[model samples]
Structures are given as structure tokens and as C-alpha cells.
Target: MANLYKLDILSPQGNIFSGNVKQATIPTTSGLITILAGHTSLITMVSKGDIEIMLEDNSVKSFTVIDGFLEVSDNVVSIISDFAMKSDDINDEVIEKAKKYAAEQKQKNDNVPSEIAEKNLQKAIMALKVLEHNKLKRKKRVKY
Candidate 1:
């Protein structure tokens, strides 16, 4: 469709996704931004949050983006994230454990950098939020 655009999402681990999507909603440092096919060409820093992508078939896929940069140009979108993974691929238990670890370390008793500890906690929280959102979406589908 004319409204769809090519999207590429990548991280150090590997390419997360590459396909045509009807639209994409990303969380930036400023706020949430929704990009369509004809979005203005620009780049911005993405915050820790879920990236929701609506595919050409209207099905939605979500990924957790810890931090990154997003670019839009010529009807194509590119996202390069420091850390990212599919919602389904993430383990909530592991994230929760990380959150606890960060919280414990945040006390400054272990002499760990508070910034790093805080960042880890924030990432774990964001990942959990994305996982929760995905679970709710799946539940809604089952009700239909």
C-alpha cells in the first residue's frame, strides 16, 4: 500500500526486524512519535520504551528498545538501538531479577556507579512494561 514504508531495526546483537510496516510508534526523549510513510526526514534520540510496529497486514509486533536513534527518509525508517529485543524473546523473570539487582546496587553500598544502576533499573522497568502490553494485546485477541 502507498501508506506503508520499509523499516529496518538493528542492534549490536543483530538485525531485529526488516520489513514493510503500515506505521510505527516510537518513544523518543521528547515524547512518543508516530511515523507514517511520508514522515518528514529527520533523526532523534529514542528513549527506553516499547516500539510498536503495525505491519502491512495490520498485525502488530512490539520490541523493547532500551535506547537508540531513529531516522526517517525517503519513505524508509531506520532504527539503531544500543539494546533491543522482541517482546516475546525477553524473559520477564530475568528482567525482574535485574531490577532487584539494580535496586540493591543503587544503594551505593557496593560502590557501583549510580548512573549505571539507575539505567539498568529503568531498562528493566521498560522491558517489563512492554511485556505487559504484549500480554494484554494477546488477551484482547482471544476475546474476539
Candidate 2:
């Protein structure tokens, strides 16, 4: 059996997830990082991407997170995100809206910071990727 540890994912809305997980892969500013039991303690800034957790039961859960901070200590992992949503919760309408808003923001030549537009675009793209990946995983499981 794999070692299990506590994982808590938090966002401004509320606690997104809290459970025991065998492993977790997070997107950091530098790159993607996978944490397991007994891993060394660390703290880093999370990037816009999918946070994948492998549960003790061997099932996987995925969440799309925007900018945030992640801390690992004493076998406990905590994620504080500005925004987060389960991949299954994302819908086409929301994705399309985000894309349109981002494009509109980018086209504006006013004082709007480009970072805002870029962040929106990144978030939309990341959500789509996570949704696609989850769909593929489900298909594979069905085939087996």
C-alpha cells in the first residue's frame, strides 16, 4: 500500500478538497512538482494549471487552480488558490466566456494591465486541458 497524507485545497470561495491522498502533482512557477509521502518540506508559488491528486483508493481527482501558494510540511500539503474549480464543474459556456473576455481585454489599448488578460487566457486554456485529460482518462478506463 502507498503511504497516505493529508491534502487541503483552499480557495477564496471555500475549502475545495480535504482528504488523504497517496500522491499529488502541482504546477509551480518553476515547473510541475510531484509530492509523495516523506517528501521534504517546501513552499512555492503555484502557477495556473491542474492540480492532480491520487487518492488512497487509487482514484484520481483534478482541480484547475489559478495563482496560489502551496506548502508541504510534515506530510501535510496545503494549497491556497485565488481561484479553483473541479474539472468536471467546468462547462463550455464558461470556457467560451472567459476566452471572449480575455480577447476583449487584450484588444483594449487603455490602462488595463496586460497581465489581467494573459491570466484570463491562461486560466481558460488550462481548464480546457484539464477537462480533456479527464475525459481521456475516463475513456481509457471504460475501454479496459
Candidate 3:
């Protein structure tokens, strides 16, 4: 049997996941990094990307992390994120509506804060990307 490491993933709202995982792939500012058991203790800032975790059952779970930090020590990895959610948590319809609303607001309200608009746009885009990735994976599985 493969060794397992503890992975605790947390969002600003609360803890999302905590379990024994075989591996975890996180997106750092530089690039994607994969961690396994016996990985060195370190800390790094995570980018806006997917965090893929390989579970003990050989299933892969993905979470979208907007901006966050990760700490690894003693075969335990902890992730604290500004925002984090499983790919399944994002609804395509909801994201589409939010994108449309942001576009309308950007056009109608000149007083809207640029930062707010940017944040909304980024979130909408990220949600769409996650949804699309899941859709493609489902399609591929169906074809096989």
C-alpha cells in the first residue's frame, strides 16, 4: 500500500477538506508543484489556479483557489486561502449570471470601484474555467 500524507485545505469561510492523500499538486507563483510524503517543510504563496489532490483511493479531487498560502511540514500540508471551493461547487449558470451582471455594472456604473470590478471579473472567469474543465473531463470519460 502507498503511504498517505495529511492534507488540510481551508477557505476563508472554514475548512473545506481534511484527509489522508497520496499526493497534492498546487499552483505556486512560479509554477505547479507536486508534494508527496517526506516532502520538505516549506511555505509558498499559491496562485489563482487549480489545486489537484490525489486521494488514497486513487481518485483525484480538484479545488479552485483564488489566492492563498500553503504550509508543508511533517508530511502534513495545510492550505489557507482567500477563497477556495471544490470544482463541483461552482455552478455554470450562476457564474454566467454573475459575469453578465458584472459587465452590466461596469457599463452602467462609472462610480464602481475598479478593484471591485476587477475582482468580480476574475472570479467569474475562474469559475467558468473550472466548469469547463470538469465538463471536458466528463466528456472524455463518456467517449472512452
Top candidate, metric TM-score: 3
Best by lDDT: 3
How does candidate 3 score on lDDT? Answer: 0.90
- Displacement of residue 83 (Cα, Å) in model 3 is 1.4
Per-residue CA lDDT of model 3 for 35-69, tens digit only, reads 99999999999999999999988899999988889
- lDDT against the true structure, per candidate, is 0.87, 0.88, 0.90
By lDDT rank, best first, the candidates go 3, 2, 1
- Note the residue pairs that clash in candidate 2: none
Stretches of candidate 1 exceeding 4 Å from the true structure: 100-109
The candidate with the higher TM-score, 2 or 3, is 3
Which one wins by lDDT: 1 or 3?
Answer: 3
Give the range where candidate 1 is weakest over 10 consecutive residues by summed lDDT: 106-115
Worst 10 residues of 2 by lDDT: 109-118
List where candidate 2 sits over 4 angstroms from the true fold: 104-109
Runs of candidate 3 with Cα error greater than 4 angstroms are: 100-112
**Inter-residue clash pairs, candidate 1:** none
